[model samples]
Target: MIYLQLFWEFFKTGLFAVGGGMATLPFLQAIGESTGWYTYTDLMNMLAVSESTPGPIGINMATYVGFTAAGIPGAVVATIGEVTPSIIVILIVAAVLHSFRNNPYVDHAFYGLRPASTGLIGAACAAVVLEVLTSIQLVAQEGGILKTAALTLDAAAPLGGVLNLRGVALAAVLLVLTNWVPKVKGLHPIVFIGLSAVVGVVFGFAGV
Candidate 1:
């Protein structure tokens, strides 16, 4: 039963999350909340691991969540479910795409999906930012998302104070390096991810 449920949930996610891997973040977040198999923090961690690993982020996330919920079998089921929609859609599209390549309706349909994808990705980014750089919801737990706003770096205060100052600082440095730095900007992204992972391991994330 758990396996079936996992498959159904991820199947729906794969069917609707059309933008790409990043766009699936919102669906995965809701899945985590509704299923109760994992928490928001767990989802964030999964996102981090998924981003760092090989293969598509969406599939990796599905497998990870499934494994957490059940085990190896759950992972297989969830992964298959996640890819089924894509396979079906791709096959159908391939069959008719040549015939309808210039159809106005089809063009409009694809165009309509753009905004939905953009909105999903944007929301995902906002959620990630909040989860990573702020301690608002982490401290709240079951209290509420905005229960309190800690505005200090007093680690001894409560819930690591308002924000993850170190995380924010690291993000700033990375942004500058990846976007503004002369030679650094050209380096592959894996280098940054690896560095960030090392930094996280060495420093660790405490309250925030």
Candidate 2:
């Protein structure tokens, strides 16, 4: 029953998360909240792991969640569930794409989808940024303009601090190296990833 539920949940995710992998973050968050299979922190870790590893982020996340929830069989089922919708959609699209290639309605539909997907991906990025750079538990507290204004004024306040210093520093260094330093900018992403891993380990050991 649990396996079937997992399959159905991820099938829905794949069916509707029209953009790329990051666009699935919202659905994944909803799934986490609804199922209690994982927490937001777990999702952040999953995102990091998925981004760093091979294959698509969404599929990797589904596999990780499934494995964590059940076992090897769960991983297989979840992964299959995630990809099944894409497979079906692609088959249908391939069959009818030629006919719709010049259809204005289809083109207009895709045009609207572009912005919608962008919005979803942008929201996902914001969520990740908040998770990485701020205290999500504190941020979730009830309040509106006043709370936001207070946080803006007292960024380093005891509750809901402005930034994760370590994460910010790492991000700054990576940005500079990747964008400004000519030599580093030319290197493969894997090189910088390895450096980031080493830095993370050092910081972890230092209790940063």
Candidate 3:
């Protein structure tokens, strides 16, 4: 039953998250809230893990969530669920694409979807920002009233005050190295991802 639920949930996520992997973030966030299998903080960590690992981000996230929910079987079900929608949609579209090839209505519909996809992807990105920044300094499991109040107020603070500077700095450095350095610009994403993982380990050890 749990496996089936995982499949259904991820299937829905993959069905409507049309703009690629990043776009699935919103659906995954909602799933975290709805299922209680994970938390927003878990999603943030999963994003990091997904970005650093092989395969599409959405599939990787789905597998991770599924594993958390129900171990190996959950992972299998979730992965299949994520890909099944795309396969069905593509197969159907391919069968009728020739007919719709010249249809202006179809063209207009796709045009409309472009903006909607962009909006969904943008919202997902914003949600990522909110989760990371809010959790980094704001989350408090236990504390005295003064400490709790301070944490709450800190969480509500806008911008960099609530942001995780270490994570932000790491990202900025990687971006600069990967984009600005000619020798590194051609490096595969996986290479940089591995480097990021090493950096993450170091950060963890250093208590950053």
**Clashing residue pairs, backbone N/CA/C < 3 A, model 3:** none
Error of 2 at 198 (Å): 1.1
Those runs of model 2 whose alpha carbons end farther than 4 Å from true positions after fitting are: 1-58, 64-74, 94-98, 108-116, 136-160, 205-208
Runs of candidate 1 exceeding 4 Å displacement: 1-58, 61-78, 94-98, 105-116, 137-159, 206-208
- What's the lDDT for residue 202 in model 2? 80
Can you give the TM-score per candidate against the true fold?
0.57, 0.57, 0.52
Candidates arranged by lDDT, highest first: 1, 3, 2
Which consecutive 10 residues in model 2 have the weakest lDDT in total?
Answer: 144-153
Q: Highest lDDT: which candidate?
A: 1
Ranking by TM-score: 2, 1, 3
1-208: candidate 1 lDDT, tens digit per residue? 8988888998998999987887788888888888899999998999889977888888899889889889899989989988899999999989897799999998999799999889988977876897778754423344466645443344553345676788888999999999999999999999998899888888774533
Q: What is the per-residue lDDT of model 3 for residues 8-112, given as tens digits with 9 covering 90 to 100?
A: 999998899987887899899999899899999999998999987778788899899899889999999999999999999999989797779899998999899
Worst 10 residues of 1 by lDDT: 150-159
Per-residue lDDT, model 1, residue 205, is 45
Q: What digit string (tens of lDDT, one per residue) describes model 2 on residues 10-45?
A: 899889998678778889899889999899999899
